[model samples]
Target: MRGKAAVVTGAAFGIGRATARLFAAEGAQLVLTDVDRDGLEVLREELAKTGAEIRTVVGDVSVAEDAREMIAAAVEDFGRIDTLVANAGIIPLQTVLETTPEDWDKVMAVDGRGMFLTCKYAIEEMLRSDGGGSIVCLSSISGLAGQSGQAAYGPAKFVATGLTKHLAVEWAARGIRINAVAPGTIRTERVRQLADEPGGPEYLEAIEKLHPMARLGEPEEVAAAILFLASDDASFITGAVLPVDGGYLAQ
Candidate 1:
C-alpha cells in the first residue's frame, strides 16, 4: 500500500480507527473523517507521531456535502485515491414495535445513505487515477441473517450488501473492485456501551456462546479482513461479503 492514498470514515474509534492505523502501517497515506472532531484530532496526532502522511476531516457521514468534501480533500492532498473503507455506521437496536420512525430514519441515514454517498464520491475520484482502486463497505452478520432487535439496523446492512454487489459488477470493467466485510460480536467500545445497557450484556453473552469460536472478535481482527480486501492480496476478489465472525453466521 506504499504511496497509495486511502480514505476511512468513522475513523475516530473502533473498527474505523483500527483500519486507518492498519493502512498507515502499510505506508498508505490516509484521509480520516469522523463526526467526533476531538477524538479525530487526537488520533491524527497519534498517527502523525508514527510519521505517516495523514489528514483529518471533521464531518458527519450522513451529510452529502461532508462526503463530497472528504473525497475532495483526499484528491487535493494526495493526488489520487487508491482505496476507501466505508466503515461509518450506527446501531440502534430496537424491535419493530419499539423502534420509532425517526430512529429508523436516523440509522438509515448514517448506515445506508452515508455508505451510498461515500461510494459515489470515492468512485468518482478513483476513476481519475491510472489504476482503479478497491472499496470495502462494513456490513454485519445481521445483514446475512435476522436478529430480533435489529429492525432498523439489519435492513440498512442488507442494503449495504446490495450496494457492494452492484458497484462491483458495474465497475469491474474499470478495474474497480467493491466488496464488504460483515463482522460479528467484535469487542469494541461500542460493544462495551451496548453491553452496559439493559439486557445488553446477556444478549452479548448469548451471542458469544453461539459462535463456534466461543469468543468475541477483536476490532483488529475485523481490520485485518478489511485490509486484505483493500490490498493487492485480494486483487481478484470482488462483490463478495467476507465474514470476520467467529462462525456466528454458520450457526
Candidate 2:
C-alpha cells in the first residue's frame, strides 16, 4: 500500500489505532478519524514520530455529513481513495429483553448506519477514481452467531456483514472490493477496564472458557486482518467475512 491513501474510522484507540499505525508504517498516506478529539491528536503525534503522511478528522461516524467530509479530506489531500477501514462501532452488552428501543437506535446509528454512510460516500469516490478501492469493515463473532448480551450490537454487525456482501456484488463491476473481519472478544482497554468491575473477572473467565484458546484476542491481531483485506494481497477476496477469532466460532 506504499503511497496509497487510506481512511480509518474510530481510529482514536484499540483496533482502529493499531490499524492506523500499521498502515502508516507500511507507507500509506492516512486520514485517521474518531469522535475522541484528544485521542486523535495523541495518535497523530505518535504517527508524527514515524514521519508518516497523515491527517486527522475528529468526527462521529454516525453522522452522514462527517463521513462525507472525511472522504473528501482524503481525496483533497492524497488525490484518490485507495482503502477504507470502517471500524467505528460501539458494543452494547444488554440482553434483548433488557435493551431499550433507544439502545437499539444508538447501536444501529453508530455500528450499522455509520458503516453505511462511510461506504456510501467512499464508494462514490472510489467509483470516480482511476481504479476502485478496497473497503474492510469490522464485524463481531456475535454477528456470525448469537450472543446472550449482544442483542443490539449483534444485529447491527449482522447488518454490517450483509451490507458488505450486497455492496461487493453490486459494485464488483464498478471495480470496488469489499470484505469484513469477524473478531472474537478482543482485549481492548475498554474491555479490560470493564473486566475490573465487580463480578467482572468471573464474567470474563466465563467468556474465556467459551473460546477454545481460553483467551481473549488482541486489537493488533484483528488489525492485521484489516490490513490484509485492504491490501492487494487479498486481490481476489470480496464479500467474505474472514474470522480473526481464536477458534471461538470453530466450535
Candidate 3:
C-alpha cells in the first residue's frame, strides 16, 4: 500500500477506524471522513504520531455535497485515489411493526443512500485519475440471509452488495475492482451496548450460539478482510462478497 492514496468513511470508530489505522501502518496516505468531528480529529492526532499522512473531513455520507467533498479531498490531498473503504453505515434493529416511518427513512438515508453517494463520487474521482482503483464496501450477514430483527438494515446492505457487483462488472475493463465484506456478529462497542439492553444478554447469548464458532468477531478481523480487497493481493477478485463471519453465514 505504500504511496497509495485511500479514503475511509465512518472512520471515527469500529471497523472504519481499525481500517484506517491498518491502512496507515501499511503505508497508505489517507483521507478519513465521518459525522463525528471530534472523533475524526482525535483519530487523526493518533495516526499522525506514526508519521502517516492522515487527513479528516467532517461530513455525513448521506449528504451529496459532503460525499463529494470527501472524494475531492482525497484527490486534492494525496493526488489520486487508489482505494476506498465505504464503511459508513447505521443499523437499527427492529421488527417491521416496531419500526417507525421516519426512523426507517433515516436508516435508509445513511446506510443505503449514503453508501450510494459515497461510491458514486469515489468512482468518479477514480475514473478521472491515473487509473482505476479498488472499492470495498461493508455489507453484513443480514444482507446475505434475513435476520429476525433487521427489517430495514438488511435491505440497505443488500443495496450495497448489489452496487458492488454491478459496478465491478461495469468497470472491470477499466481495471476497477469492487467487492464487499459480509461480516457476522463483530464485537464492537455498539454491539456491547446492544448486549446490555433489556433481555439483551440472553439475546446475545442466543445469537452467539448460532455461530459455529460460538463467538462474536472482532473489528480488526473485518478490517483485515477490507485491507485484502483494497490491496493488490486481491487483484483478480471483484464483484464478490467475502464472508468474515466466523462461519455463521455458512450455517
Clashes of 2: 0
- In the range 78-153, model 2's lDDT, one tens digit per residue, is 9999999999999878889999999999999999999999999999999888598899999989879988888899
Backbone clash pairs for candidate 1 read: none
Give the C-alpha lDDT of model 2: 0.92
Clashing pairs for model 3 are: none
Q: What is the C-alpha lDDT profile of model 1 across 140-202, one tens digit per residue?
A: 998888988899999999999999999999999999999999999788888889777999889
Query: Candidate 1, 194: how far from true, in Å?
Result: 2.8
Return the candidate ranking by lDDT, descending.
Answer: 1, 2, 3
Query: After aligning candidate 3 to the native by TM-score, how far in Å is the CA of 105 from where it should be?
Result: 0.9
Tell me the whole-model lDDT of each prediction, alpha carbons only.
0.93, 0.92, 0.92
TM-score, candidate 3, is: 0.98
